[model samples]
Target: ALAYAAQAFQIPCVVVIREDAQLTKLQAIRRYGAEIVLVPLAEWQQRLELEQQRRNLHLVHPFDDPAVAAGQGTVGLEILDAIPDLRTLIVPVGGGGLIAGIAVAIKAQRPNLRIIGVEPEGAPVVSESLAAGHPVAPSRLDSIADGLGAPYTRAFNLSLIERFVDQMRTVSDDAIIEALKAVAQQAKLVVEPAGAAAVAALLADAEIERPVAAVLSGGNVDMDRLGSWLTR
Candidate 1:
């Protein structure tokens, strides 16, 4: 949706997907007439910079882009508006864009509201960064949640997370899968693995407070993988 929206608005956009991303995303981008860039895990950062410079791309940092952040902030605003008494918000952290934006908006309006970030255990950049007291790249990137599999944390995202997020948790792939199934059966929502990380954290961690709302970030899942997962 973000890519479509950007394209619709005449923004020359190119999607950067992991090298191993399923064919579904590729097909969708092709169908939508958008450019797709596949970056190998080893060369992502360098290639990204080179590509941006080569194309003179108007780079929009997923986490640091003010416009994108503001757009994500609207989610926090809507949550507060709908649940006036809401005291906490749980957000899944991939590159930290969504949580950073939500934290900023929620804290600005309700300073006391706690904002938590959830990450996949296999790719816990945010959690590991917090532990190391600085942004640290993961030695190995391995996660079923492709969206959340950022090898390195951006400085801008790290700053926002350090300042705004109250807590962070990491959950395993099995836990994430259970959360996905639960949401499918109960909420009737199809969520990607990264999108369900927050729910997985909530289910795995018993200490979380009630009245907590989690962001189900995206619903783009490969049909073949979804069927395989369901059968498993």
Candidate 2:
């Protein structure tokens, strides 16, 4: 959606994804007119090539860019506009961009509103980072929530979470799968695992306050695997 927003202004963009990334997400990025590159792993070499070419290009880090974070905060603004009396927000954390920005925006307006974050148990980047008082990367991450598979969080994003967020939680892949089904059956939302992370927390034996808004972040499930996964 962020890339789509950029393309609306005719801003040429190039997106890099893992070779195994969801086909639905890749196709959507291409549909927005952005160039796509599928890499095997961290392709810093290709990034260096872009720097050499320069072309006045600013490499947009997906979640660490200040502009990107601010842009994401608009979701919080929209939610407040629609539900002024909302008391809590549950957002999925990958690299902490979405929740950090939302916390900043909502807390500025309603300081008392609780802001909670959830991530797949396999990749507890934010929670682990907070615990160590610094960013920490996991050696091996395994989860069905591919969208929440960021290896680590940046220091700036970590600081923002430390300042603004109220709680950080982790849920298992099984929990995410259950939440995905619940959203599909109960809410008619076909969300990816990462998108269902917050809902997963909600579905657990959690002590949550009412008037809560849980952000369903994405729906780009790989159609090829969607049916089998949904059935199981």
Candidate 3:
């Protein structure tokens, strides 16, 4: 998305991606003419900051900046516009920006509505942070959902999530794959694992109330991966 925006304005954009980031996502960024810097998964956050400082780049942080969160809030507004009577919102969380932004927007207009966040079990940083009542960093991030493998949530994002979100749940890779298959077969949506996290939670739990909506956030999986998972 940032790459596309930069392309629109004809600005040079550099994306610092984890070494293990999805090949499809890397290809997409390159297609938008963005320069890519691959950093080790453990050092990505530090390298991103250093790169910004060294280049004097105008950093559009993935989840930390208020401006980015505000932009993501538009998704919430659109959701309400489409479903005014929505009782529950299920959002997939990585660094918590998207869910934070959505929660703020939805809670402002509909405080009574429930907002739930879903995270990959392998990298449930948001879930752990919320449980600890503070920001918590995961020791390691190991998930098929590369987009949902954030190592930690920043304080600002965590605060917003704590304030507005009602619950946080996690789904295993198996559950996520199952949900991805279901979405493809039933909903005819070819979604990536991160995109299916919310659906995974919804399918795993039967107690969630009616009028629920799950955000499908991406569809940039490698074809080989999709084929392998589908055949499995």
TM for every model, in the order presented, reads 0.93, 0.92, 0.97
lDDT for 79 in candidate 1 is 98
Candidate 1: residue pairs that collide: none
Q: Where in model 1 is the C-alpha error above 4 Å?
A: none
Please give the lDDT score at residue 113 for candidate 3: 95
**TM-score sort, best first:** 3, 1, 2
Q: Quick one: best TM-score, which candidate?
A: 3
Candidate 3: segments with Cα more than 4 A from true spot:
none
Q: Residue-pair clashes per candidate, as listed?
A: 0, 0, 0
Q: Please, what are the lDDT tens digits per residue for candidate 1 over residues 1-232?
A: 6477776897777766678986776777766767889988778777777878999887766565767877999999999999999977889987787888889999998988989898888898888887888888875578898888877776777888889899898888888889888888899999988889889988876777778888998677898888777667
Clashes of 3: 0
Instruction: Report the number of the highest-lDDT candidate.
Output: 3
Q: What is the C-alpha RMSD of each candidate to the true structure, in Å?
A: 1.7, 2.0, 0.9
Query: Which ranges in model 2 have alpha carbons more than 4 Å from their true place?
Result: 44-56
